[model samples]
Target: MERKLAAILAADIAGYSALMEVDEAGTFQRVRAGHQELLEPEIQKHNGRIFKLMGDGLLAEFGSVVDAVECAAALQRGMAERNAIGSESNPLQIRIGINFGEVIVEGEDRYGEGVNIAARLQALADPGGICVSGKVGKEVGSKLAFAFEPMGDQRLKNITEPIACYRVNFDRGSPDRVEPHLRNGYPTHKKTSIAVLPFSNMSGDPEQEYFSDGITEDIITDLSKISNLHVVARNTTFTYKGRPVKVQQVAQELGVTFLLEGSVRKVGARVRVTGQLVDGRDGSHLWAERYDRELTDIFAIQDEIAHAIIEQLKVRLLPDEKVAISATPTEDVEAYTYYLRGRQFLHMCSKSYMLLARRMFAKASEIDPDYARAHAGIALCDSVLHSWRYADVSIETILATSAKALELDPDLADAHAARGLGLQYGGQREQAAAEFKLALALDPDLHEANYFFARFFFEEGDFERAAELFEKATQVRSDDYRSAVLLTCVYLALGRRADMKRAGLLGLERAERELTLHPENSSPAQLGALALAYLGERDRAKEWAARTLAIDPDDLNAMYNIACAYLHMGEHEPALDLLEKVIPIASVHRFWWSTDPDLDPIRNHPRYKRLVERTTLASP
Candidate 1:
């Protein structure tokens, strides 16, 4: 007998006895088909070995808890897909349970408390669902994309002590609505969907563009609070900024039923806002409104637009929803103005822009000491600065600022997201996961929450879920080249060749579009190089890499990313050269370097090994 720490996976067919009694031969054959086609293959794919098999159940052992949990999800998903097309009245459903603990192994058989806990958990699972021990859940809390509903402490049938458990929400395997590729210029999800286009800056002063953008975002936020509506995220709609796009075309691209077009003009104390909602199906105006009022009435104007759209659509808003829609982030318009200005630079991906954004946010907070969103903005700026290696930001500072934001406005989704990012950076995985979940629950279309959560999964090497989150982020923020490019890398790692190509091409297209809009920005080129390299356009990738370096030779993030692109393109020497230059100053990202699959090709190289050694010595 040998005792070892192993991840145990136990699975059994639901209602097996009933199915067998109905049609013994058919049930057996279907079960065999499931084992042959789904179970065995997925287990092997995830590096798990089936140690034992019964008539309607099996037990497997994996070296990693991650692999075991992933295998359980795959098993349940495969069964769901199979059952979807099955004509049988009694389709086979699998209930899976996974646990990580010490197991007593005896010649191809695993036993002990681990196995017992897993079996008990499998019985606790609903048909076609997975249940995992608290240990497994904690280990995978932030790593995987699956939502875990806590089951509290459970008393196992034969176990001495109770163990905590969680039910994995693997039902979110794919989009429940119309698939992206199959969408054809219509809202098919039985929800009233709309896209709010960026309001035109009719004020004549280009410096006032931020004000118009802020008005547009506020209206979008107001409408989004209505549970009956499906609002396209701000980032996705902003991609059409300054572009002459037809309403129907925009609807087709965004898969929305309605489009909101607007313009804002502000001169000193007076402000005018005009908005119209059009039926995307036929390009007919459903509602139109214009409000010319004092600048202090700007918030009222936004609420009016939201109410008009809801009334036109006949959406029933609950009391809470009504309050949410009408609520303002700040009473002070000056603070609000400064906050909007800060938001203008939030996604610029440059240190100078981030610094300026931070200053703007700080000014807003100074003006209104209780402006929760401004504090959230400042926290996010610090998070990004630290993440991008642009500045040294203490984890304590990030946590404190985000905490302040949450304390000021407990329900603010942005505050939750900011806190989540800081908690993730501080290595409080469970707390971070809860904050992210809360943020998404409050505002499902939040780009920052989806993007940051996707980054967490990507860093954890959970490529499948990371890809899903990235896909969601891309849908929300179509102009976000970073998420698009990272999606390509994730698909590449998952061996989804076609998806990789599609994502890589899409990333390059978005990056080029961004470059056309902002020619001086080098971040697009930095990411575009990776997309090009993954797509096998070696020369173009190298050119883009050189372009990034030319734009800013001192940009460590660009240098590191280009090094990855070079490694992917099989240009080892230049990749090594860049790594040598970047490793010392970029020591903060050593964890990323260790985990990024892009560096796998040269991970074992002597020079790369030496660079890893150098990183340890350079760490603060």
Candidate 2:
């Protein structure tokens, strides 16, 4: 083997397998045409040669880093133009990664860390985009017209050291167009970012876990108020709960500059909170503090932590941001405690948990009638319970509680989101849209706002809008599987077969991760079954379906979701049987029954038509 320094360019068709599954012969022909008509000519024109082809991907070597970078940009631009006019249902897009490093050349092919880094960077690139290591970025800097967006330090799989990466932006001259560089639809933050991991429960009681979790979430929320700082959402950060993690590893995975982790202990009438902020780049402590105070000073402790972080980071807090950060939700510590427990239950995402969460929120409201966040929590639980057909909560009650929340704190994003959900369920689409818009305007990163808004669009059969919002929801809360799973339906409806398959794969991956943490939580299994069936894992899908059913034989939401999975797996009779039981109880979101893409396989069947008609007649 001859060792040489070369610019390695790796390119692959995104979701090639899914495209082939939809139309085998047509996909093959498209790939061949792309290589012959576009790829080969572009590489040769830029003084490069394709050394190896790996099914849907190819590895090419260029003499200069400039030629490699320029060739990648041109090839991607060409693919975009061709796909713009293509008649195929699935658009053909390629992701490229370029690295300038040493390679071991054997015979006619290249092998080494250089080629490996290029391949991994290709996987990190967005479909129809390019990613390059810092070496390539620096070597080709200002030598080309293309702009580069830094993606932070990424720890690629099996690589010893972290790599600085950048995404190649092709539309630098076109201000009106937005060609986003995404990794599985998750947006990259190019700002000062931090993730606050779940605080350790040092109270030595399992029941006190909620207190620590709540403290972590509140600190995250408080930090998020600063417009200059990008705070990772609770859903994504809490995934690290109870796990032994390395500071640099967590930062690399989360793509953040800093990590905040600590412990919370509450013993009788006293509370001790210890927090430390670490610079993820070098795992150096930027700040550390411990607060020992009365239980009633919990809010003060949270405020001090938030202020310490702000001061350490030198983030300029606006007047409104400071007020928002230090503001206490409730004066009564007991009410706050109950509200935190309610939030913990709400995150469980089950019928029983929803009921328990609602009761806890109700108790909090009863204790402090003017507590806006508590009332907002009640509205959310009621909306979810009523929508899932789990409880007999009236729409009037949802509207009243949400309205009371808004009356108390109109600027609260959760209150507006809860109000919007209530209005959407009450058949007031315009008002709901307004509420959703206002909620998002107040807090663009709020998961509930994005999730509820996406549901509104999905029910209206606006697949394009729904997909965009669902993708945003998944990005805001990286650990959420529901939005990713729902994107499978929206993408399928829009005839984005490759996107649909990618979403299903991502949803299943996240669901599997959730199962590792909460093995008995059947919601993940229920959703995972649908994603599995979409990916053509029939037996595994059936296994997951059986597990979900065994966990809750009479759960309406589980039965409905599993029925969708059954349809995907070609079990029409069983799907129809489950739908027969679910349709009658689906008092809310009747439109989901009428327009679900999963039911299209059996839509024309006599039994399916009858079930739809029965639900239509039963609808008020």
Off by over 4 Å in 1: 1-195, 204-210, 227-259, 267-270, 278-287, 310-322, 584-604, 616-620
C-alpha lDDT of candidate 2 relative to the true structure:
0.83
- Clashes per candidate (backbone, < 3 Å): 0, 0
Tens digits of per-residue lDDT for model 2, 325-414: 978889889899999999877866767778889999999999999999999999999988887777687889999999999899979999
Root-mean-square deviation (CA) per prediction: 15.4, 9.0
What is the number of residue pairs that collide in model 2? 0
Query: Against the hidden true structure, what lDDT does model 1 obtain?
Result: 0.81
Report lDDT (CA) for all predictions: 0.81, 0.83
Candidate 1 lDDT over residue span 125-163, tens digit each = 767888888778655545565555444355454566767
Question: Highest lDDT: which candidate?
Answer: 2
Alpha-carbon deviation at 190 in model 1, angstroms? 9.9
